[model samples]
Target: MSIPLVIFLFAWFVFLVIFTFLALVSVVQMLRFGVAGPGTYLSTVTFLAVTGLVLGGVGLYLAGVDWNATLDIALTPLL
Candidate 1:
């Protein structure tokens, strides 16, 4: 029932990779196939900015964490 805290970091990394792929594909589709308009660029910029802020916050939060820690999870039987 012991889990390493670094596992969370690993999970985040996986999520980041997936998010990056999806975002790239979305932006490509918008710019390549969608209509030409200001809203397209605006949406792209907003999406990137929001993503940056979110990842930056996550980085700042993780900065102070000690990855060497372990979490003990206990499960009780439910009858």
Candidate 2:
């Protein structure tokens, strides 16, 4: 692979790993502490955690080779 592709893949992988880990941690924390904690703030935390996970997944799908057939082919020669 070309250097830019390699770099993009590496950066995306790292970003996904770190973001997923953080989202998971937040979800766990929300589950654990939410019930005993404040009502309004707990809901906000849950919302943020779920949103983070969903956005992270979308980013992964976009960055990974999942959509390669259409876009990848066009970009392959450039790479």
Candidate 3:
């Protein structure tokens, strides 16, 4: 089977969109309902920091990839 390498990039973009929506919802829920304390603020800050670091790292890694290509896979059947 063969598929365009760009398919993975499109999939990643979809995942990123969903992740961003969920992250926004989580922060809103946390702030709207959680007790007012340093713990709540700290947790939100930590979550945002980790999310930024991970996304930044992935961006750097993806910058070098050549998206104009295709991937081919071979499958063998055993019966």
Candidate 4:
């Protein structure tokens, strides 16, 4: 893999880890505070965590594929 691709993938991985950690912290806080107020904060944080995990998994999967082919397929509709 090229240096740039490697860097990009590494950065993506790092961000995923960071966001996951943040989500976990939010969950812990919500639990400690109990289901007070409207509970929207807990729900929103949970959704963000789930979305981050899904996107991170997809990013890792794509990292193993040929970038040219992936981009071509992804951008085909726009061309």
* Number of the top lDDT candidate: 3
Residues 9-74 of candidate 1: C-alpha lDDT, one tens digit per residue: 899899889989999999899899877888988998999899899889988989999999987766
Comparing 2 and 4 by TM-score, which wins? 4
12: Cα error in model 4, Å: 0.5
Arrange candidates, best lDDT first. Answer: 3, 1, 4, 2
lDDT of 3 by residue, 1-79 (tens): 8787889999999999999999999999999999999999999999999999999999998898888877776553556
Model 4 alpha-carbon miss at residue 39, Å: 4.4
Better of 3 and 4 by lDDT: 3
Q: Compared with the true structure, what per-residue lDDT tens digits does model 2 show for residues 1-79?
A: 2243455666877987898788778767777666665784768677887777887887787766633333344446752
Candidate 4, TM-score vs. the true structure?
A: 0.51
lDDT minimum window of 10 residues, candidate 3: 70-79
TM-scores, one per candidate: 0.85, 0.45, 0.85, 0.51
Compared with the true structure, all predictions reach lDDT values of: 0.89, 0.67, 0.93, 0.69
Please tell me which model should have the higher TM-score, number 3 or number 4.
3
Which 10 consecutive residues of model 4 have the lowest summed lDDT? 67-76
How many clashes in each structure? 0, 0, 0, 0
**Residues 1-79, model 4: lDDT tens digits:** 2243455666877997898799778777776776665576768667778787888889798868764432233434653
